[model samples]
Target: MRLTFLGTGSAMPTGTRAQSGYLLRHGDETLLVDCGSGVLNALARTDVGYEGVDTVVLTHHHLDHVSDLAVLLKARWLAGETDLTVVGPPGTSDLVEETLAVHEYMQGRLDLTLRDRTTGTFDLAGFTIESMAVRHSMQCFAYRLQPADGGPSVVLSGDTEAFPELIEFADGAAVLVHDCSFPDDVDVSNHPTPTTLGEALAAAEAELGRVYLTHLYPHTEGRHEEMLASLADHYDGQVTFAEDGLTVRVED
Candidate 1:
């Protein structure tokens, strides 16, 4: 699977990093994970523009994550696409419904389908996805995806503090893109600091191929090296701070 980082910043927008969005493409199918405020513009920059994205999978209802849903749906509609499918946690349907409610102009312009996958495994965009609940401000989830045809697996830890269960869910995946929202000195909650994230990674020892820390806040502006150093003290692995528009491939 080829994954692209559309937006990597936190709720607060950095000029370089927009918000929380990621794109995964395999074969002819493209699945977008989380569409934040600036994600639609980012998507336009890719070969698969907003019109080419067949489906969008959201992790939660946070504004930073789903801000562009209406915009994307409208973009697809204007591009002459007839349908768009959205899959996410339990409240996904409600979220979409309310979105259309607010944006009354967007009611029924396109054929919209909503799927709530809160448990078990399901097939979406040619991948078998297993979801688990995560620690967050609201009903958030993390996803583990394996392409039906083959290749390595990828895990996405939506927006959560690093925890053992989330790490275990990511075990053995080729790539684990997690929520590292700030540096160690922030004293924040509902998001992991680099040290805490590193400690969790060490305790679980998932041995993932490469760990990309994303959802960065402005406080993490110039602290990438310091943050990596702190994380390396506990968990030694191939780690990087994901930047907007950076694409990563998951292969065996």
Candidate 2:
């Protein structure tokens, strides 16, 4: 399984990183994890097209996470693609319904499937997805995806606060794409700090092979080394500060 970091920035975008977006690919199946602002353009930068993306899974309804959703739907509709499936939290269906309501042109042009689930496991094409609700300001979820053919598993922490449950959810994952939004001393509530992340990983029952820190804000600028140092104090593992367009292949 291959995971691509389409956007690595936080709610606030930086010059280099876009907002929250990730693309997972297994064979011919492509799953877009989050469709935040600039994600369509980012996907265009890759070999994928908006019309080719048949499945989308969102963690929450935050604008930074779902800003370009309607745009993508419209583009696909215009491209004569009618079938699409959207999976997310409770409000996911409402979000899409409201979006399509505003754009009457694409009303009957596209066949949209909305699945609103919380804290469960489901199958999406060749992937088995396990979802758990995380501690966030809103109703948010973290996803653990495993290939049906017994390939590597990846866990994506959408936008969340530091909690041990998150570690458990990410247990045994080849890659834990966590939301490390700030440094330890930054004192943010709804996001994770390096210290908190290390603590959680240390207490986790499963050994995470690698960790990729994403959803960074400007406060994290020039502090990557500092964050690494802090994380090293608790968890001794391979870690990388994710950047846009960074592709990571998961191995079992």
Candidate 3:
């Protein structure tokens, strides 16, 4: 499996980064996690086209994560590509319906499948997509996408305030793509700071193979090295700072 960071920035966009979006691909299947602004443009830069992305998994209803979803769907329909499935938290179906309703012209142009995910296991084209509720301002979830054939699994901790549930959800995963939004000193709610991440790692010390930090805020722009240093104090695994367009291959 290959994971690509389409955008690593937080709610706001910066010169070096876009918003929150990622692409996970294995063979012909491409699954999109979070479709923020400029995501379609970012996809154009990669080898995958928007039409090839059939599944979308959202972490939460934050605008930075789902803002450009409708735009992408409309563009795909205009480009003559159909068959789309979007799986997300509780409000997923409502969000899709509302988004399509606003763009009524593109409603009947494609087949859009919407799945409202809560806390349970779901099957998606031979892959097992498991979701666990996390502690966030709004209803949020962390996703673990595992191939039914027993391949490597990936856990994406959408946006949360480092909680025990996150540690449990990420245990034994090949890669944990978590939200490291702020610096160690900066305190923020509904987002994980480096200090909080360290505490969480220290508590469970799960055998997480690799850790990739994403959803960075502007406050963390010039302090990437410092953040890595802080997280490394607790996590002894491979630690990486997610950058726009950076891709990592997952192997068993």
Task: Give one digit per residue, the lDDT tens place, for model 1 in 1-252.
Answer: 899999999899888887889999998988899998899999999999998997999999899999998889888889999699999988898888887898777777879889888767889988888898999999898999888887788899999999987898888899999999989999999999989999999898466889999999999999999999999999989999999989988886
Predicted candidate 2 versus true structure: per-residue lDDT over 1-252, tens digit per residue: 889999898788788888899999898888999999888888878887777788999999999899989888877877888788999999899999998898777777878889999889999967899999998999999999998777789999999987787888787889999999999889788899999988888887877878999999999999999999999899899988999999888886
For model 2, the local distance difference test gives 0.89
Error of 3 at 226 (Å): 1.4
Candidate topping TM-score: 1
Pairs of colliding residues, candidate 3? none
Q: Which candidate order results from sorting by lDDT in descending order?
A: 1, 2, 3
TM-score of 2: 0.97
TM-score of 3: 0.95
TM-score winner between candidates 2 and 3: 2
Alpha-carbon RMSD of each model: 1.0, 1.1, 1.3
The numbered model that scores best in lDDT is 1
Residue-level lDDT tens digits of model 3 in 1-252: 899999898886677888889898887778899999888889878888797888888999999999889888887887887778998888899999988888667767879889887899987865788988887899988889987667899999988888665887788899999898999788578898887887787787477878888989889988988988888787666778899999999875
